[model samples]
Target: MRHFIARGAGLLALVALAGTASAETVLGTPLAPPALNADVTGAVAKHFTDAGGLVFKDLKPSKARGGKGYCGKVATAADAPFVPFQVILEAGAAPSVLLLSDADGASPAISEENATLLLKNAGCLE
Candidate 1:
């Protein structure tokens, strides 16, 4: 019985390690989610006309394209609630702004039919 318990513990440890191994990073550093720095916020703001009022939070490196971009939640104003948003950047290509919606089908501009899939693709969802 002790042998079996030890084996189970080992298996659990391996599973935990595997989960951390697959996490995406912006600067090749594990356990550090990307920050919503000025460059990233600027890149996203350029796509909008009035982004001065926007506030970003919960930023993370995108898993797509081998962690080449960033994803997070943004609030249009201090009084507004935060919404999921993604900015996928590619070399020599304009950044892509993926629209997302909240659980109630509101926020992030509008309710997109593919919001869930987009969120998944952007790594906004687990």
Candidate 2:
């Protein structure tokens, strides 16, 4: 009976420790954007390229909503049918990119399906 009790207590302690470690892993670690727009630009360019779409040639800092984090515009390539896109970067969190369009417009610059695919491919949720 004593041996069984000790084993159960050890198992419970192990489970508690495991839970704490998993929580820390899910909390995420912060990351700083690379200098000269290398990190953000590269990630966006790769996303478009992998999706077989027009690549974003220029990425410049832009206004962000709520002023919470960094935001930028992904400029459209010359003569490309694609409209400009925007991206928001938050430290220790995933970046979000969206196609620009009028609020009243029925059509979005990028379809929701494509946007999700691009983001997933770019590992933006990480």
Candidate 3:
């Protein structure tokens, strides 16, 4: 009984932590930091040729041209010893950029993903 009660309390704490964590944001709102992408199929295929990630391109709401948002895609490594992953970095509706990166080396691997996710959670995916 005691053990079960302790586990339940721990789970509750974890839930609380998750709820608070999702609220953190780097950029303010609407406006996002910046990203890269590939607007064409050829470009998307060539994306991340360097490391193993993609880039975002062609942003929306062209304040200069008109419209709004961003969009894009990602490609995981084809070889082994590397966990294939994807990165869709967008400023608004589409990913503004994409690039190839280490699958699971260290912080760098998930660094951008973390940042992007943060911005998304903060509603900064503009």
Which candidate tops lDDT?
1
lDDT of 2 at 105: 35
Q: Give the winner by TM-score: 1 or 3.
A: 1
Candidate 1 error regions (>4 Å): 1-36, 101-111
- Which stretch of 10 consecutive residues in model 3 shows the poorest summed lDDT? 14-23
Considering every candidate listed, which one attains the maximal TM-score? Answer: 1
Q: Candidate 1, residues 1-126: lDDT per residue as tens digits?
A: 222222221222211112111112222222242333555565545544456566666777766654656777666565677666666555685455554533233233333544555566557765
- Residue runs of model 3 more than 4 Å from their true location after superposition: 1-43, 50-68, 76-95, 99-110, 118-126
Query: Comparing 1 and 2 by TM-score, which wins?
Result: 1
* Candidate 3 C-alpha lDDT tens digits along 12-73: 22111111111211211222333322232222343333422322222233221122223222
Report how far off residue 39 is in candidate 3 (Å).
Answer: 2.7
Model 2 Cα lDDT, one tens digit per residue, 29-115: 223443434444443443342322223433445444343223233433435453444455566754443443321232333345544
Each prediction's Cα lDDT score? Answer: 0.49, 0.35, 0.28
RMSD (CA, Å), candidate 2 to true, equals 19.2
lDDT score of model 1?
0.49
Higher-scoring candidate on lDDT, 1 or 3: 1
Cα-based lDDT at residue 121, candidate 3: 34
